[model samples]
Target: MCAVEDHPHGTEEWWDRLGAVLFGPWAPQAQPGSGHVHCEPDWSWTLVLSDYDLWCVLGGIGRARLNGQDFTVTSGCVLMLRPGDEIEVRHDPANPLTVGYQHYTHGAEHRSATVADTCPPHFLPPRHVRLDDLSEVRRHLDGLARLRRRPGPDTRARVTAALAVLLLEIHAQAARGTGALPPLMDRRIHDVVEWLARHPTLRLGLHDAAASADLSADQFSRLFRRETGQSLREYQVAVRIRRACELLAESRMTVRQVAAALGYSDHHLFTRQFKDRTGTPPGAWRRSV
Candidate 1:
């Protein structure tokens, strides 16, 4: 019917309440659903959901009716269905849908209905978004699957943390109110950002990045700053530092090695830059993590 039904999770208050619980002591438990599904042509889905469900399309096309509202489903699309909502899904037989899904909820047992409305707007996140890079999100989904299969309190904790991170990532990618970049510009900038994020070690100068985007240096710089709120060099530095932090925390690499891997020829220079951005040396940050 393409009409959105009234549901608690569809409102800002519901998100606010959930946000409070998420950041509070009694955080929601993350339960991984069926990993990736290669749907058969005859397959269909319908449910009156009892928990928060996240569905990410991996491939193929489909149509979903959430609480009677229709949505076109395609690769990279993500849908968030909440308690008390109804969903029906079907796909084309020529190219059946493939999807990854997970569930999140409060308490040991799943709720039978929606919570009462009495919350804030601060926790409102996008209910749907088509990510520019799905692989990164896919990694988190797969990690959740792996963690859920393991038997340990530690793994369960990690699953919850991973779910939180995935939500935050979606929030960051979602467009907020007013003054978004034009679609073409947004896509171009997205490509640049994805490239920089994927190759933090590569030294891509401002002019080169501009050329890659088929724009003059000044034009590209202005557009990039307008779209991302950061200059090209600043963004690149931030990307490199973020990767450095990950390596320092998760890998056996020494600080010098990390610096070198990120294209910092001088280890001292990397340390100085890292300290300027993080207020501590890489080693200290690693230890704290």
Candidate 2:
């Protein structure tokens, strides 16, 4: 057996660090010039990026050359490029490209750190992943674009959370092709997660969730744990707690109101759960934030 310490930028320590930071309290700040761009018919440019760049093709056809590899960029196509990657981009004259792009940086931009370092962890999205259905991905991109135009009190937190989700979706899409699990099963697990996130307040039972995934309850339980490392019930609780945090931080809602909104009949239970997960009661958490 051999120990390989020199991991690449998107592997080993890089992935671990990215996962921690994105899931933790830190938010990646989009540089001043980050946003969507509509490329003209004759538009073409080449540049070496200095930080992380997320590029999504909202519409139209384009050609991109990244590190000497050419890509035909179409709608639903996503690309995550890192520092010093030379990229050349252009679009068709008849249909101009509407591109949603963001330039941001997480701390683990280099490959120097060893796997044992306690840097913030992040999930590294593939360099390219073409989604079969762009509806959901486009929704997030549109939300991001709109958020930029209408900044609000919770804009930073919302942006960070949304980007985290966007990356997860991209990683799931990439996983469809490369993961050891069957693609359909892997996709079903992610779909269930998305459905749960969308309906955070719903008190769905295990059977209902299994039905949504088109699997038996026992099967869904096993696979969900295998894929996500958490039981179905635990994930649901996490969803509620995450939403509770948002409500407490962003709105004038009292802790009781927040608990009620999340389908908690007894506010005390909510407080206990919040404390168990966050090391503080809801009120204290709200006050700290």
Candidate 3:
């Protein structure tokens, strides 16, 4: 389940309060586990992590330094930092900030459960979403907490599904409210382009390219154009044409042979694509060059 707390980490008193809230009345938690204290040049802060928890910064404008990268957190942004990850939360002292966080942690049995090696690492893409009421999120967290408190054969499965749903919701919200393309888009698209360049003659599909980039087909298409200024189809055709030109210039292969080598089923179709791109058919273009 999700638990939320509104506490500032600007003072020692606040840190003590936060420690009590995160570690429970039974034990005093420390950094790299339930809570941490960081003193930066301009500000000081505290970070709290629940066991296998999902956290949401309900209200505040701050930056989270995770894995040496900064993520901006404002109202309505939810962050799920996996166990053992480091997060620092600093507030603007001039404004005397108020920050809210929703926490979720798994039970003892599920706490040791590792996401399948096959499961893809979760990525928090950049987005701009206005903060709305978070009652629904709170409810989900409550349900999650209840499920965690109970241990059974079905407990682990239920918790996993709940976490999946929470992650999907976060992704959907970020996608819907965004001013910038996620950094993941650029990295993923670059991988796709590189893969195509390395294997131009291999038969590739839209799905294949998307998978290589670790994105859904539609997401990859939109972000690919936004990042590279070219549609995936356009990019694929350009790669094929470039490869075909290299073959035409470097090899003594016939047009049909080149087309087949480039995964084109019809020689005429390949010629049409080449002519459209170069303003000349394959043979004429080769002769002219």
Whole-model Cα lDDT of every candidate shown, in order? 0.74, 0.74, 0.57
Point out the higher-scoring one by TM-score: 1 or 3.
Answer: 1
What order do candidates take by TM-score, descending?
A: 1, 2, 3
Q: Using Cα atoms with residue i matched to residue i, what is each candidate's TM-score against the true structure?
A: 0.58, 0.52, 0.37
Question: What is the C-alpha lDDT profile of model 3 across 120-211, one tens digit per residue?
Answer: 22232222233233555555556766766687999756755665455444544443344221333456777788888998887668887888
What 10-residue stretch in candidate 2 is worst by lDDT?
Answer: 1-10
lDDT of 1 by residue, 1-289 (tens): 0112211222455545555556553354675465788999899999987767788899999998877678888898878666777989899989999999888764433333233121132343445567665787899888888877786969766777777777755544443221121223466788899999999999788888888899999999999999999999899999999999999998999999999999999988899989999999998999898
lDDT of 3: 0.57
Report the C-alpha lDDT of model 2 over 73-97, residue by residue, as the tens digit: 8887777776777989888889888
Better of 2 and 3 by TM-score: 2
Clashes of each: 0, 11, 5
